[model samples]
Target chain A: MNHSVRAVDRIAPRRQGNWDWRAAGNFVAGGAGGGVLACVAALSIGLGFDPRLLLAVGLAMMGFGLTCVWFEIGRPWRAMNVFRHVGSSWMTREAYVALFAMGTGLLAIGLGTRPLVAATGLLGLLFIYAQARILAANKGIPAWRHGRCLPVVLSTGLAEGAGLVACAGAWAAWWRYPAMLLVPLCAWRVIAWRRYLAALAADGAPVGTLTAFRRINSLFVWGGNLVPVVLAGVAVLADAPILAVLAGMLTVAAGWQMKYSLVCRAAFTQGFALPKQPVRGNSRTGPGVKPGWQWNRWLTD
Target chain B: MKRYAMVIDLRRCVGCQTCTAACKSANATPTGVQWRRVLDLESGEFPDVRRSFVPVACMHCANPPCEEVCPTTATKKRADGLVTIDYDICIGCANCIMACPYDARSIIHQPQYAYGDQPIASEAARMDSQHIGVATKCTFCKDRIDLAERTGQIPGRDPEVTPACVNSCISGAMHFGDILDSDSNVSRLLAENESFRMHEELGTAPAVHYILDRR
Candidate 1:
């Protein structure tokens, strides 16, 4: 999906400088943790397996991700002000949802109640959706602003969660219950990636951003998705717990890699454009200049 | 209904970057941060090249995307059609920075001086700690405009009341006034020239418009 981009990257949109490794860590850890919580809740509600250990681990992961973002902020004490714009801001919504998710998750663990666990799972799903909206709200970035980004984030988070469910099976006796669902979730995630990339290409993204996504395309499709699905299948065929854990680990790692790429590497701003290129002497305007966006559907002629 | 706007005449601009330096001197921004900048854009092939020096700053949009994504309500628009930042409440999340399509906003994490490792005499005197860790941008010389309003003088018509960049423009390429007022400098210039706002396709409805020609 490459274009004949002869222009230098400087002529195009520059990669966003605000968010970096710390911001990427939030999506990586938070998404995986929320996914794990949802997966555990679904299984507990259906199969009646007590996933107290993994559930606690899920909460801890989310908290750790929040801590990473706290460090990224300049005024840590003023962090409470993030709730100021609940009416419009997605970050505010994410915070409110997080507070509820934590409360329900704690009550669920303390009471050992099925309904509370189900509520926590619902909150986890909301958290993932909120996080996706957080990225998509950035109209500046080409990759984040795309409508297709929602499905990619949602599917990736759930896939990672299912992977963790498979990994948790290594310690728990009733591993077969959640591990059976891992292959299907991973496949769905791959399909999501395929659709997102195709849409992004057709819409036209920053050359560097598209290139970065392309670099991960093979690793994501082959090494990440196919290998994990194959390993999970082998685990089911041979009844091997280690193989299932390996598949889960690979799936989780791949999801993290994609998120990191999306947040850090592919976060390029929609650079400056001149709609009417000025000719030297003529009073009339010439062709427009959209540097990196060769096929931008949004460009007004 | 005073919707203040800036009009840059592309035909008159010489790409001297005087406006960029004027903005920095007026605002006292730290090293490596310029609220107003000139983008050197060269498009087309070898023989048919078209180069343009586009002077850009905050659009102070009618519909600001930065204001939409600010969790703390720090990035805000005033009644005078100026976009501003409330540094006191901003937690430095940089969300507004990501949401700004014009690349106008910036957050200076640490205190940086013009000179190597130390603030110069003037830099130290004017250095603001409030902007160190929060989102900051071009305020359309809000202070000057406000002062003019208090002093009972027209903002864009008076050089003392105008934005530093517009006053400093060497070739008279820049004009600033209430765009809603038909008789105002910006409104008259826009009415007479072929004008287009940058990234108007994004639905920002940017106040800063580029005038391609002079009628």
Candidate 2:
């Protein structure tokens, strides 16, 4: 029995400072851009309008997101080194996928090739998935690493993309065609967000993160999800492209805001924890401790 | 076959912070940064309370998330299970910082001098330019271990070959050795005590083991 006396307390979840607005920008711009490209591949038939403008916009958004990442990194000159670890790194895969997506989109725009459009669109979706993987791979971050984050981020991107395209470019005549996608994708985004919130609570998160998310619940559900969806419905029913454009803008804005919250506001590091507490007595233990994370699994353990 | 590991005896550790200072002196880290840290963990109630000092650093995990997520291939795991980062190759994307569950990795954007903008002679001489703008952390005192191993001196037995933190621990609570060797100090300590690795649920297979009991 050899132990000395020492007092101890708990450590709360620490907010990560490595990634900021620049990181969120990648997810927002890249996701919306990818979504737009996917829409072009899936819903571009019989729309009586040329997609050259859409292609240019999607490529431009992707470039903007990539530049954000470029600025965020400390060693901007060595960014090309990102390609060296494609075998295990999702970021490397993202870079490669982005390059392919960019090339195919440019070629599709330049040559007006149908197969190239589909290829570029598929690559864009892959890029979004890769971005999701990048967030999920960070085990230190509880909010981003959740399994539900995949569906949430993916659905948001698709919704944002469709929303932007639905209200733009000769939309007065063909609003119904794009609205068909905008409404459904917006609804799906809502469902995904709901599941993500549910899982975060059920699966357990830092108390601060949970609070931050709860604070934005009304804004996210009403302003982002419900309101935009209702607006989209009114636009289609009333044959009003202007209302549809408003709804689309709302959908895109909401998605960006949500991503910003996830990456910056609620991105808390899984702080230190001890599974067992050692007492100042003969080789005996007390209780386990995980600061800030209070959940069934941890409490029960 | 060798796997480097550290065994920290929670019962013995008093949180003196000598190891932390020793590590800083040996590594010459910036003022705000600490590669080695001792976390003060308290649990239980007021009447029946329990507190312990947790000395933590880079675990050099068998399945290192940092190594897996490094986009530049700068982070690598040696055959002997020593996870290392190549400062020259690292682009400082901070992917490794996010991936590491232990919060062991850090990316310093600029060099900080102990005294104002002017560098004291020791600070200027000890400053590592390559470490700037890259992810850095404790390497189990890799330089000392490698140098000792190259000269055919055993790491665990030789004080010069061991980590600065382990050598500096006042309580003798920290032990470093090859866990692969059955008779090694670290393996023996683990076998004779009830030990647990931090974040074992994450499957990082962290090399740092905390002993909760004595033989």
Top TM-score prediction, candidate number:
2
Residue-level lDDT tens digits of model 1 in A269-294: 98877777654466567677777764
Give candidate 2's total backbone clashes: 2
lDDT of 1 by residue, B1-215 (tens): 68899999887787898999999999998888899988776666766566677888899999998999999998888898898888899999999989989988888889987668888899889999998888889999999999987898887889999999999999999999988889998888888888899888888899999988655
lDDT score for residue B197 of model 2: 94
Steric clash pairs (candidate 1): none
Which ten residues in a row are the worst by lDDT in model 1 chain A?
A1-10
User: Model 2 over residues A193-299: C-alpha lDDT tens digits?
Assistant: 88887888888888767767777777888888788888888878897778778888888898999999998998888877777775455557877777776443322
Which ranges of candidate 2 are over 4 A from the true structure?
Answer: A1-10, A46-48, A170-172, A281-283, A296-301
lDDT of 2 by residue, B11-52 (tens): 899989999999999998886778998888655566767777
The docking quality of candidate 2, as DockQ, is: 0.57
Query: TM-score for all predictions?
Result: 0.95, 0.95
